[model samples]
Structure formats: C-alpha cells, structure tokens
Target: MLCGCVGLVWLYEGDVEVAVYLIWLALVFDFLDGFVARLLRVHSPMGKELDSLADLITFGVLPSFILYKMLQQQEVDAWVPYLAFLVAVFSAIRLAKFNIDENQQTVFIGLPTPANAIFISSLIFVDGSYPSLLSYPVLLIITILFSYLLVSPMELFALKFKDFGWKGNEVRFSFILFSALSLLFFLHLALPMIVMMYILLSFFVKIISTT
Candidate 1:
C-alpha cells in the first residue's frame, strides 16, 4: 500500500510517469502476496481480507486518482472529473465478488482490478503522445466503459499455472509471448495493449474451446 500512497503523492506532484511506475510496482507486489502466502502454506481469512484491502488502495483508489487527475488536466467542466471515481466504485464491487465467487478460481467473471488499473494508468503515455486521443469526451467514455467492464459478465482468463508444460496451456503461453514481444518492441506503450490483448485472447480461447 505504501507504493500506492507514494504514487498518489507523485501524481499530485505532477510526476505522472513516476506514479505510473509505482502502480506497476504495486501490481508486482500484489501478485507476490498471493504467491508468498501459498509458498509459506499460510492462508487465513484475515490474510485474504487484508489482501483485498491492499488491492482496493493500490489497484482501485490509486488508478482512480490517476484517471481523475488526467481528466482534471483536460480542464473539463467542474463536476465532470468526479466521474473518474466510478473506477474505484466498480473495482470495490468486483473485488467483493471475487472474494466470494468460487467459480472465479481459474478464471475471472469480469475484468480484474489490476488489469483495469494497468489499462487506465497506461493511458498517460497515450495522453503524452496523442493529446487529442484522450480528450475530455474520450476519457469520460473510457471511464464509463471500463467501469461497466469491471462488473460485466466477461469471462477473463487467469494466469495461474498448474505446471510449466506446453499441453493444456497453449493460450497462456501465446499470451505471454505476445505480451513479452509487445513490451520489448513498444516499451510503456505496451501496457494498455497487453491488457487489450489479454481480453481478446481470453475470448478467442473460449471460442475455440466451445468448438
């Protein structure tokens, strides 16, 4: 959560790049929380609850702040920027469902908060390169679209690996390869692309599975 707090500070300081990097760092730690818990064979309701709280701050609130600041920067109407908080609101609902939904063990029922955070935070680069692409209207649309996606009934795949083998993991491996190459070739520009690729890849996998 410190990373998230620091990100908010940097964001307020007008250092958006640093704030975005912090969000990425927080995501890494978020993944580690689960991995370490499993590694130590220590699992409890308290730990799970704490994990969700940390996620709310890092993935939910931090990203919303970033989006809020972005909209504010656009100099839109006074109350319009407040809409960015919808990301946090929907994120909380998504996380709450995740905690109780047993069907989400190997797949997500909607866009995961972390992925949503990454997609929103990565928009900083788009704003940097193509200022017109993220105008007030566009950002508002993104806010509403993603807010709905957070709680929508989209079946997104999880990156959990039962084994490192090739069989039964074709889609996962392909996704990893695509993400790696995108990052290698595009750098920060790949952040949002990777998230989009993840969603499309999940849909593709589902289609092939039902055939």
Candidate 2:
C-alpha cells in the first residue's frame, strides 16, 4: 500500500512510467502477503480486513488516479475526469464482495481488482503510443465498461493451480503460455491485451462447459 502511495506521488510528478512500475511492485507485495500468510497458516480476520484496505489503495485508488491523470490530459469537459473515480468506487464494492463471498475460492465472480488495475495502469502505454486513441470519449467508455465489469456477475477463472496436470489445468496453462508469448512479442503493448484475452478465454471455457 505504501508503494501505492508512492505511486500517487510519481503520478503527481508526471512520471507515469514510475507510477506504473510502483503499481507492479505493489502487486508483488500483494502476492507475497497472501503467500506468506498461507505458508504460516496465520489467517486472521484483521489481516483479511487489512488486506482489503491495502488493496483498495494499491489496486483501486492508484489505478483510478492513473486514469484521472490520463483524462485530465485530454481536452474534455471538466466533469469527465471525475469519471475515473468510478473504478475506485466499484473496486471497493468488489473487494467487499470478495471478502464475504465464499464462492470466489477458486473462481472470481467478477474482474479481480489487481487484474483491473493492471489493465488500467497499462493504458498509460497505450495513451503514450497512440495519444489520439485515448481521447476523452474512449477513456470514459473504458472506465464505465470496467466499472460495470467489476460487479457484473461474470465469472472469471483464477490463476491458481493445485496440480499442474494438463486435464484440469488446460485453461491456466494455455493462458500462461499465451501471456508469455504475448509479452515476448508485443512488450508493453501486450498488457491490456492479455487481460482482454483472459476475459475472452474465460467466456470461451464457460461456453464449452455448458455445451
């Protein structure tokens, strides 16, 4: 979470690249916190609450701030930039839901905050490469779309692996392979695409199972 705060500082400093890097650092800490807790078998209610709070800052608010900064750069209506806060608002609800919902043990009911954060934060690169592409309208649309996705009741597969067997882990392994190749081939541009691919693949798997 402190990394997230520092990311805000960097965002204010107009060093968006640094801000994004700090977000990635926060993601590392987020993963380690859960890993360490599971390793020690020390799960507490307070720890869970703290994790949600920290996630709110690091994944929720930080990514919104990035969007806010991006929207501010565009010559949009004054109220447009405020829409970015929708991500933070929905993220709070998402985290709250996750805390109380038992069904999310192995699958997410909606988009994960960290995944959404990564997708949003990576938009900086998109905006950098194609300034016109991230115009006010486009950014606003993305914000609204993802805000709804946060609580949209759509199921997304979690990347956990209890056993690395090919039968049950086909989707996970395929996604990981595609992600690796994507990063290798597309570099930073693959970040948002990877998230999109995750969503699409989840839906594809869902359809397959139903049929």
TM-score of each: 0.95, 0.97
* Alpha carbon lDDT at 199, candidate 1: 88
Highest TM-score: give the candidate number. Answer: 2
Which candidate has the highest lDDT of all?
2
TM-score of 1: 0.95
> How many pairs collide in each candidate, listed in order?
0, 0
Model 1 Cα shift for residue 80 (angstroms): 0.7
lDDT of 1 by residue, 1-211 (tens): 8988898899889898898899899989989888998789999988878788888888999899988988888877889889999999999999899888889988999999999999999999988887988889899999999999999998989999999999988889999999999999998889889998998888888788889
| Whole-model alpha-carbon lDDT for candidate 2 | 0.92
Q: Give the range of the ten consecutive residues with the poorest summed lDDT in model 1.
A: 46-55
